[model samples]
Target: MRRYGPALLLVLVGAAILRISAFSALYLRYVQAGLRPYLIVSGAALVLLGIAMAVVRRSADDAHDDDGDPLDHEHGHAHHGPRVAWLLTLPALALLLFPPPALGSYSAEREAAQRAAQGVGVFPALPAGDPVELGVGEFSSRAIYDSGRSLKGRTVRMTGFVTHGDDGTWYVTRLLVSCCAADAGTSKAEIRGADALPADTWITVTGTWHPKGKLGTDAAWPPVLDATSVERVEQPADPYEKR
Candidate 1:
């Protein structure tokens, strides 16, 4: 226990640092709101356990020595060895000083932005109404994968950034790619009769899906939506679709 105490302390400090950082949300999902108190108690316990182990080791070394050598000398005449254990505090200190921002433009183009190819059948059918709560990522993924079956005549209401095209028509597009912008593929459902194009404007669209033609320079498979109405909307806190 004495020999391994410093390693255990390092692990506990690492956990504490992660709990207090931007990755806190990820940990909260597993540990719940009690993480703060848990970190406090666990950190104190580990620190005390480590200190006690070090003290016990020192006492044992003194008892076994007959030459009257210092405990530090017996371990290896290095003052910095014990101090190295404190490096575990660096992550916590950095988080306390500078936390990172939420995932932004960097993650905007990830494939996760697109809908999953599998489980398209599990999505609920669009209900007939003025506004329908459609998961834009899921709807787009389904439309892309099983275009003929999923959205041939189905009406959907979606919200996303508006990007302009060369023809003066604005496309309501969401980037779908794996990881980041480099691999991002666009999943666009057209917005006809929409004027006053606004780049990156968050907008709500109510429309019925129809196969029109090619979209963009890639000449990607075109699955257009004949929009009934379009209105600008405020950006949501979690703008991206959660898989």
Candidate 2:
């Protein structure tokens, strides 16, 4: 434990900083209301645990002896003195200072390729509604598997950031990531009558699924959703899907 004292201290400080940042209203509200308390408590616990571990390890190390045996001497030195483990926190600290933007062009292309190969027939049909919340990741995966068969001719309402095109049309897109934004895939349905769409504006769209064209290069996966109406909406604090 003493060998990892610096690492433990770094962990404690990192946890504290992250928690404080998250607790700030502007940042907290942008993430999600439901998750705020959980994050706060968990972060606090992590900080406290790290501190306690470091202290206990230091205390134990102070009571140990410097033996002449090579292995013992090495172990004692490694555990009883300052170590390099704390360096592991550098990248994390950098990230906290400069959070990356949402997954963009690269993710979009990857998602398009994935949809192309798998197809979009399996997506569940959207029930008729003025504002239905559709999970972008779920919908994309289902479409790839089932080709939007379940969503045939049904209207769906979805909310997401707007991605604009040069042709005056805009898409309400969300990234479906496997782990983080770095590996996320993008998915979107067309929004007609959305000529005035604003980039990055969280909006709710109501539309019906219409088999218009093929998804990607494959004729097997067909396009779905022709939006009837679009309205800007608030961004959820926790933007990521729960599952």
Which candidate has the highest TM-score of all? 2
Candidates in order have lDDT scores of 0.55, 0.57
TM-score of each: 0.47, 0.57
Q: Candidate 2: list runs displaced more than 4 Å.
A: 1-9, 12-112, 119-132, 137-153, 166-168, 214-224
| Model 1 residue 212 distance off true place after TM-score fit, in angstroms | 2.7
Residue lDDT tens for model 1, 126-231: 5675455566555555555543354556667888777665576666765543433234455655577556456777788888766543322122333566788888
